[model samples]
Target: NAGVTQTPKFRILKIGQSMTLQCTQDMNHNYMYWYRQDPGMGLKLIYYSVGAGITDKGEVPNGYNVSRSTTEDFPLRLELAAPSQTSVYFCASGRNQPQHFGDGTRLSIL
Candidate 1:
């Protein structure tokens, strides 16, 4: 069974462009998170949701947003993409157990 899936493994965007990174899981997890990792750096949380109809910004939420409308999906939206936003993004989901990650999406802003 698929654990977690992410779409558009790689993408290029103009400085002002916007896009959504899609993430889905079949584990029926209630907790989901979006994180970005810069080159050679650790992951930085962008947003997270505990359950359907509930969401919250994380440590680095600028230019990004997220919504959790179901137990199986949590998508991250990037608005007004900027060079600083260029990085590899990862989506994760879990319960009290260890989180499972999706194949990261690589985003480049030029």
Candidate 2:
């Protein structure tokens, strides 16, 4: 019934700044995910939630935080942004494996 949506398609931040990458889905999925893809590299899972009020760390959870307050929202937070954190972030949702992905957020840290 819905697809993934991400905000701030692009952003530039100075080292140590903090920001939240917004993600939302309207498909009423039980599984939601966040992933970061560095240049020339495959996507690394940052975090995932099986349902509302539950979350778990993934392969590259450092420097990132996620919360699933409702089935439709899963936001990724970055505190003290670092240059190494620069990458394209993708939000996905599905019943099993991800079925929908947002356009992606291109983040750059100076």
lDDT tens digits, residues 1-110, model 2?
A: 44899998999999999999999999999999999999999999999999999999999999999999999999999999999999999999999899899999999999
> lDDT tens string, model 1, 1-110?
89999998999999999899999999988888899999999999898888899998889999998888888999999889999999999999899433899999999999
Best by TM-score: 2
Find the 10 residues in a row with the least total lDDT in model 1: 90-99
TM-score of 2: 0.97
Query: Against the true structure, candidate 2 has what lDDT?
Result: 0.95
Model 1 residue 1 CA deviation (Å) reads 1.5
Candidate 2 weakest lDDT stretch, 10 residues = 1-10
Against the reference, the lDDT scores of all candidates come to: 0.91, 0.95
Query: How many clashes would you count in candidate 2?
Result: 0
